[model samples]
Target: MIQPDYIFECSWEVCNKVGGIYTVLSTKARTLQQQFPDHILFIGPDLGHAGQAAEFDEDTTLYADWRRTTAAAGLPVRIGRWRVPGAPLVMLVDYRQLFSHKNELFYEMWESFGVDSSQAYGDYDESCIFAAATGRVIESFYRFHHLESQRVVAHFDEWMLGFGLLHLRKYTPRIATLFTTHATTIGRSIAGNNKPLYGYMSGYNGDGMAAELHVEAKHSVEKKAAHFADCFTTVSEITAVECRQLLDKAPDVVTPNGFEPDFVPTPDRYPARRADARQRLLRAASALYGQTFDSDDTFLVSISGRYEYRNKGIDVFIDAMNRLRTSADLPRAVVAFVLIPAWVYAPRADLKATLEHGAPTTAPLPTPFLTHWLHRMDDDRVSNFILHAGFNTTDGERLKIVFVPCYLDGRDGIFDTPYYDLLIGMDATLYPSYYEPWGYTPLESVAFGIPTVTTDLAGFGRWAQTVVSGRDITEGVAVVHRTDDNYAAVVNESAGALLSLMRCSDAERSTIAAHCQSLAARAEWERFITYYYTAFNHALTAAARRADA
Candidate 1:
């Protein structure tokens, strides 16, 4: 097997928990550590206030010489260990300095690589500036250590880091470059705009769609990066199709995301941990609704991810919950939580008071469905949907929907528990994603022995189909067939899947939970990390050929 002496992985989410990419890198770090040890390094944009970044443990002594030289040469960075499983070495670059050279960098990219920066807006400039800075940091370190002759790999994740890969390829030609697009800019935009992405994928022109969706600059950079990188990869086969059609480049590898099981409780302690999680979740729901829940009888379900109403199927999840409420055959009282983070203003004062002290009144709180107060309460889609759907915590209702607008970082006032802690309590999870590159929520749910319902539209859901047959929750995951025009059918199928889970006998439920764990075991980093090694080898061989040429 071919191996790089040093690997440098760059992503916007490194040490900064924004999305699923954070989970990917953080979890994969330990496995990569086992293979590469101190030879691997992660690069990320500094969060400005170092004190605010709790995940980074700065170690000034580890790279003092390199830091001093890099700082002297105009690039300042914080050398540290990410507070993840492996505690891998990391460099948080202060990319703000590069903003001054934004135009120069963009022009250089355009002139050299044909990366069109003329129509860039929003986060394009910020992302590219940081990406270019990462390139410079890698170049500085490579030169500082005289690693030109050594086998080295520079891996950049997502379109946000596309410029970094291009920069690295241009400046550090000896370093093998790999670029991974979790989801194509144009593909995501097409889905987000309510277009029939899958149905008309082949007919869609990447550049034309980019112009129509006002994502030309991001598409341009992403497409060029895919073509320029020595090895280009994506998270899943579904996304590989999107990359081929939308980006005009087939991925060299489909590097699926994998979970690190270190955080999951041991078999001996899982029961107690699960019980505690259930208690906390029920307590929060009870506080929000001012009604105590029978822990044994209540079925807990959740839908969480980025608050993309249509793309993440937040709308479908809400509609499905609404459908469940009207079902006469509903086996148990359902408490469905919308755990997506939004512009949370603060924890609900009344909910907090109720959780701290006993509920003064048994009646539902003013907005019985919300656990936290959103900044724009009136305009928030989830809040508006709950209101319009007439969802309520009525005394005899069969279903209750609670929207948690805050990130569950264990300090979000209410739960005081991390996301994974609460995740273990879920009886089932639903992620009927319309455009997920790789759905992590469903995967995480199953990893915790929770049966999940996702749709065929998701990359993870498709992967699940390969692992197990049939669309049954008993098989650990139920991948409902979803299409652009099948919103109603998807909602009904999701509701049916939840009902099926709720109706499972104790023995059957236990078996299903075991199945969930068994399925998740197949997706561990130990198995999936080989694809990354394959990508590294491809990049290295390509780089060698470039050198020869």
Candidate 2:
């Protein structure tokens, strides 16, 4: 392993916690921290997202001299430690000042690397400015620290930070650069815009599709960075294919995302948390539909992530629930929760009042399925789909669909629990994604000892097939075969997976859950981090060769 003396990792999700990249970096920080100590640093935007930085324990005095020096140089940064399990050093850069030079930076990017910024719109300019500012911070830090002789690796993540990789390549040629694209811009755009991505993936010209999807500026920068970086990497084998087809640059390495096992509660503490979570979830469901449910008899299942109706398979999940509702063979009552965030106005006051009353409810609340009220209730895809499926009135339904349309960060008022706390209580989890790159939610579900159902189209599902040597939901994960046109079949298979799980005896369920957890053990960072080390070595060796030349 060619480890660096200093490693600088940059991402738009360092402390912001918007998406899966946040999970990837935060979970892997401790292992890296153990090797590098304070030499490893993470750089992120200082957007001051209210209480989002709770995990960031700022220590201005730790890097006082460098902070003053960078301040003098007009690059404001707050030095801190990410209060995750690893507590690695973190630097949140204030990139607002760089917005003034956005045009000049874009012009230079176009001139030096052919990153087309002409068609940039919306948050593109903001993200580009942040990326440029990240480059500036690293350049300043490297010089101030006077580490020209030391081997350094700078890893930039996703398309959001692609411009920063270019900035590093042009300005800091000695620094080994690795760029990892979790998903290609044009590929996700094609899937989101209702195009057949998998079927037409081979024939689609990335540049042509970028123009067709109006993602030229983003696609150009990502492609250029992939070409310029010392090493180009992605998170999964499936996404590597997308990079080859859509980004037009096959990755040098595939660093599948890994999780820290420490995040899971200890076996001693598990029972209480699991019971409390189940009670809270059951109580909330009871209050929503005004129906009392037996905690032991109720089977809790959920699908949680960013709300993508087709892409994340909300439509298919609802369809399966529709099938489960009418299936007479189900032995127990199942409560399905859609724990995805939407444009919510606030938590429902009536539900809060009902829960606080601590009384069993037999009268349903108005718009009972949703835990939170959305600003665009009429336009919300999940709610509209469930409504169309006749789930608006689920009082009589055995398979109850409850929509918790808010971030479950232990503060959603109803659950008052983080995602993993509730996730551990689930009997089964479903993430039938149609356009998933790595499928972290399903992976996470299995890690928590919950049998999960996912589609082969997902990278995690494909990986699970290799690990278990076959497709069996009973082996802790059910990898359903999905394609661009197998919508109905996928739905039927997903519903069948749930039905089979419900039919399992207690002994069978225990065996299956244990198997799922064992599979998750195979995906731990201890096993998966080697790929990253290989990628790091690739970048460093290439950079060394270039320096010698």
Candidate 3:
């Protein structure tokens, strides 16, 4: 078996996430380990969610403690292990404990370290503390892992791991570091389409200046990661182009994201399942959303992902829905709209948070590890929410709204849980992000034999557009653009596309689902993992020749 000395990938969102990095790593870790031969180690800020989990073996226990020394330096600390499927040397780094040390670290860095938390790391707030703490953690990892080096490759998923890449590169020249920015800070900030909302000045805290500077520092990290890492890549070619223009650093490779075929429950494998899924979901969603629909007035429309507003196209999609309902004179269809938007905050934003847990909120986590973050958490309440969708439907609305804007960390992922249950049942998906480095839902939807309607902006949509035989693409994976002057037209077209999909009888949608199944069979892990191997080999071989030179 071929193996690399080490594989390092970092995400600020780990089990306790604030963004998409968590989703990519957690979903791909199992296959990643097999491709690289069980040498992948997660570098992250655990926050508090990672305590002692059942996944840790004795040897990995040492690795857990090694990570803990820095992450929980100031707080009450414990160790946790990630239970990945194929990866043998998987380690989950928890950052919850960082909350306690933030203030002290910033104070010390200012007074003794001669570093102002505001200038680069943060300015007496989240930006400062988080960056500083994360930087320190990466610094420590090198000390711990550098001495026992073999052939190694480290990739930082986003800027959160920027400082660590530099720290390692200075001392361990042999270790190849690849930095991947799924989306650039400048790209997202500009795509935000509004300055004041996610502006450089406006921030999680009311302290405006720190937010502004944090934006700058984030851009700075992009340069550092791209310039410093041996090889760099983005999730899709579109994203790579964006990165190159934004950072003036062209990605060496464009590694597209691949979903697990069998896990997605595509249409072909489950020929008879679509009708059953739709019926089951209609009953559940009907009771969940509390709308009355006669037998004929039912349609299932869905859009799920973090709430990036302009980036994810939720508002445009909503407006499109309004048009679809208002413009045409059709029989009242039960359009069950299910929205799974991530990052549950942003009240002032047009796409304001909607949908209270109509059902009893599932009994909270054993002790609510997220007590502090609950208000800001775009957390997935799947267990309680699955039950929310479990109600009986005499008449289901054509639309079902499901909003999941946080980290679906556990087994309840869209691919893993009833989330797919909801997908298998929906007539169409609404994902119109302004800045999606890579969108996985469209791929998943197509796999379920349900065609998707996404935008060219996302990595998947951009790539799928180029694929010659999309008979392999899931049933309804249609790509839409958000740049149109008339979003209403965009919406109309998108909705019309979705309606066209529904126009197909149940069997036709299933046939489309079969095409998606064939598509997934080709998107196997066989070729995907080879890139990591190739990247590591390139880095190692390049480093070896450099030494001889």
Candidate 4:
């Protein structure tokens, strides 16, 4: 039971909600805090803006003394607590002060660790500066406290912070380093570019692919950090294979992402919350299409996550909805919502007016398919797909697709409800991902007792197989097998799975929902957090070995 006396976790997403890594850290924070208490510290870049106030509640007095010491050491930090379920201790550092030293730092990284920053562009420089600044913060903290004998572990998440791990290795050798890549840059790039990743994964040289795809700098730092760290880890078994093939280093352990259901409403409050969500969803649909849908019979289905059209299976989801609409012997009215966030100009004024009026509409609202108007409707993939399919949200259509292009943070103008609030109202979710390292959306859906249809390509779908062991969609998780060429088959399977759920009796649906929640319990941090300890131990043990050597 080798334990870290202090755990310093750093990520670009800490308190900065950009993507899935934020959920991974924020959800797991409470469990880690319980074990380590105040010893667990999270570090993130403090982009000087007002938006951080919502997620980070700063407490200058909490670390006033140490913060002063860090300031004197040339590293100014905002000591605070992340405003999440755990409310863990967080230090958001202003790394912009180090921008002048960026070139010198990049030069040092290139000379010392062979990290090629010459080809870096876009956010590459900013991420590197932040990473180096984060490392300096840890170094200063260690020296200020004079805890050389402490078993300290500094964990870096994703390639964005890989340079920090290298920084720690060169300057603060006493701190055990662990680097976890949630997804490889080259792998995601290959998928995004419509290149076949899995088929040619064996022959693909990581460096070559990175150069060709113009992600050389990120891949360079990440690959080097993977080899240089005391412990290299990834989030899932599927990603481990990616690390081995792409990064050229097999992970020491797999730390699967876990969730906490603390936000789940109490048993007594469940029905009311669900009913409220259903009413809001129905109201929005009625306002858009001008026809009231039966709340009890209308099946609420959704697909939510980052707007990755092909990667997150948004394209396939639309295809399935199209298939369901055109098929015969349909069971119920299906209202599908594409809840993924996109670049929105503003909330549709007509939709807002309709929602506020609280009246069912029969005439279609202008641009009825989308809840919000986007800046570049011409370039929007989802909108283009819906239009290309020639499906409109007319009163005669059985299936309707509502594109919510804004974050549902209870103030998206249309829903006025947070994601979880709306998620609970869903009868089923479809996340037939083509390149999901670990599908958090589907996991969240199942956690809320909404049965989900996901492909085996997703890490969660693969892990669900072990939970029920040979049970099919009856277990509330329909795992569809998907390959590079199985696009049409996957769409058909997704549609068929939804049809099965619709055909299920009310009692059967309840049983399936119960089973969904049951499976979600197995994925809770209480059970899955043990793997994190494994990675921590590996990091500490490797550090001890290197120190002795």
Candidate 5:
């Protein structure tokens, strides 16, 4: 296998934790660091206040000489270490200085690579400016270090950073470029718009759909980057299919996302952590409902991700919980949590008071299901579903739904705990996604030794089906077969899967938990990082051939 002397990976989510991409990069950092040592660097946009954020610990002296040179060249950056497991070196580039040159950059891109920014709007301008800045940063570093003859790779993730790959290819043709689209822009738009994406994927035209969805600018950049990059890659086989159809390109490698075991508690501490998590979760639910819950008899489950009602299957998850509420075979009382963040106003004061003081001796608090108050409570889909569907957690109800519409970043008032802390409390997780390229939520759940129910439509779910034979919760993951037209079947299957988890005996549950951990171990970066090396070798060879030509 060929290896680059230095690897520079750029993403909009390097130190910024916006989405699953953050998880992908942060978890994989340690493995990359182990292989490359200090030779690997990450580049990201310098959101103004990033220096003060806990995720970034700045160090002005580590790269002082290069920083001075780059600053003089009109690229301002902060050298730091991302506070992930590996603590890898990071460079947060302030791209605001390039905004004034946006028009010129866009024109050059259009002339050189046919990237159309004519129909750009929303975040297009900002993202492209940042991307161009990253390209400049990489070039400046390469020149300052006199690395023209060394093997180097610049990897850009998602369409948001496509412009950087184009800029690098144009300015530094010798440096190999890799572009990975976690999900195609037009493909996600098609699914989000309630179109039958899977059913009509074969007949759909990428350009035509881009025009129809008003995503022409993003689609143009993404498609061009994929075509122009020395190596193109996506997260999973499912998304590779999307790329082949929607982006008109096939990935050189399918690099499935992986997790690090460092985040999980060690064996000696695991039991105590699990017990504490269960207690806190039960206490919070009991406080909200004005009823005590027996931790032994209550099954805690959750569905968390971006608040995409249809795409992330939040709607189906809610329906599945409703199905479980009335099922006679549900062996344990369920406290299902919807942990997706939304436009939240604040944590509910009454719930906080109850958590601080005690559960009221009287009736349950108003809006007993919500831990936080959303800004548009009247218009929120999850809130509306709970109310309209009569998800009343009465004195004797077997199922209760709690809507946690705030990011649990250890400061979300009520829980005052980070997402991972709360995630350990879940007995099972449901991610019945309709268009997930790779379902990280379910993967994260299983990594924490919690059985999960995911649909075959998700990339992770499809991968899980190949690893386990039965497709049951007993195997720690139940990959339910989901199609665009089978909403009802998906919900029923998901509910039944959860029921199966709840009904497991203590010995059976222990076996399932072991299976969960075993499955997660198979997906560690140690196993998955070879695909990345393959992609790197492909890019390097292609770039070498281009240089020869």
Candidate 6:
């Protein structure tokens, strides 16, 4: 292994209880340290989130002069650090002032541009002051580690730290810069502040919200980051195609993201582990919602993701549930529809209300994004519609739809919740990520020893088809192809496949789940993290050659 001496990173959600970026950063911390003998300094702006930083130990006092130096330089370092498993060095770039003021700056930019997010997407440009200061702050931290003459490399993930690369690129210790766009900023930009259910779209433009600010021309941040860094990447292969076409830069390599397989037990060791996971799910469901449910009596089909009603095929799922429930000669199966949607803060008033009212629609749910949040909405009326919708609760036939709107701490929620147990017990995982750069949830659900149904648009689905012994068009976890001329036929066929698995013998289900888990392990982080090290090495080798020239 060509271990580098340093690795620097930035994340807005590093300390904040935000998105998948936290999981990505925390997991990589220890692994990067193991590879780098000297230091793998992680510099994320803390805001108030620094207090909740995991792996936190007792605080050490920093000299006022050094703190003042950071503040004077505008980086405002409030240091609290943690060394995760397998990491060599630990450094927290806690900047309470800068982080806390992000909202203020977001609005200031909006006001200064004379436009509001209500009309167009809101984007806070941090390529200037913040990047400049953070670059200096990181430089100081890096110098301390490289005093022993360490080969240095740095990474800036997403637009949040786009400036970090710009600031760090010129420094002598800056061996290589790798920029990754987890998702296109321009893609998220048009969505403005819309809820996931209401996916926002704008005509393709690189300038993005900058157009509202009246910049003469437009450009992609992906392209900008590519130009700034020595190498660039997206989350998956399909996403790479989109990036190349849209951003005008092809990623050098596809560093696919993966879940830690062992995080959730896969029942390969103990045959009864599946039953135990199911029992746990039942108990948690009863405890959390005051409703008794049996794992056998309940057939669980879940939709977990950012709730893009169309893109995620949330519409298709609900419709299929309705169709499946009402089919003739079909046993009145006790089916539970579980949606642990991301962006729960977005208003789901009408969507949740319709479920409450038992009013079904063939078309998508009639709700727009940017609606304020409404939670704790389970009333007797909603519960009644869900229970009495069509099947028999009296003799083992009913459809149960549960919308869990809280944060799923990997350890507590699905990760550790009866959720995985329930997954192991479920009929199938439904993932119709219409625009998935790559889908992790379905891949993960399978790793929990449950089969999944994903669409072909995802990078995972494409790869799994190559390596995984997939379910036939009749019974295995399938990737639904939407572009087929017969869309209805394809969907109906997938529904039949799902229904068969739901009614399969216990032994058959276990066999499929085991196969799925084995497929995922082949692509787990053990193989994927090597990509990060390799990508950095590629960039540095190229950089060295350039210097010699």
TM-score of candidate 6 relative to the true fold: 0.74
lDDT of 2 by residue, 468-510 (tens): 8536788999998889999999889998888888888989988
Give candidate 6 misplaced runs (Cα > 4 Å).
1-3, 15-17, 49-55, 58-90, 96-134, 146-149, 170-173, 187-220, 266-292, 329-332, 341-397, 410-427, 469-476, 484-490, 546-549
Candidate 3 local lDDT, 236-299, one digit each (tens): 8776766666677788777776666545643365645666666544443333344443433466
Q: Which pairs in model 4 have colliding backbones?
A: 290-361, 290-362
**How many residue pairs clash in all the candidates, one count each?**
0, 0, 68, 2, 0, 10
Model 6: lDDT equals: 0.56
TM-score of each: 0.98, 0.98, 0.72, 0.98, 0.98, 0.74
User: Residue 257 of model 4: what lDDT?
Assistant: 88
At residue 295, give the lDDT of candidate 4.
94
What's the lDDT for residue 219 in model 4? 96
Model 4, residue 534: C-alpha shift (Å) = 1.0
lDDT (Cα) of model 5: 0.90
lDDT of 4 by residue, 59-171 (tens): 87886888898788677899888888878999988887788888899999999999999999998998889899999999888987987999999999988898889998998
Question: In candidate 1, which residue pairs get closer than 3 Å at backbone N, Cα or C atoms, i.e. clash?
Answer: none
Instruction: Give one digit per residue, the lDDT tens place, for model 5 in 1-549.
Output: 789999999998998888999999999999999899888999988887544364778998888999998888788899889899888999998888788898999999999999999999999999899999999999999998999989999999999999999988988999999999999998899999999999888999999999999999999999999999999999989999899998889999999999899989998988888888888888878877878778888999999999888999999999999999988767888899999999999888888887888645356778889898888789998899878877886776889988999878888899898889889888999999998999889889989999999888899988888799636889999988888899999998898888877778999999999999999998989999999999999999999999999
Q: Could you tell me which residue pairs clash in candidate 6?
A: 30-86, 30-87, 33-87, 33-88, 206-219, 207-218, 207-219, 277-421, 332-397, 471-476
lDDT of 1 at 352: 90
Which of 2 and 6 is ahead in TM-score?
2
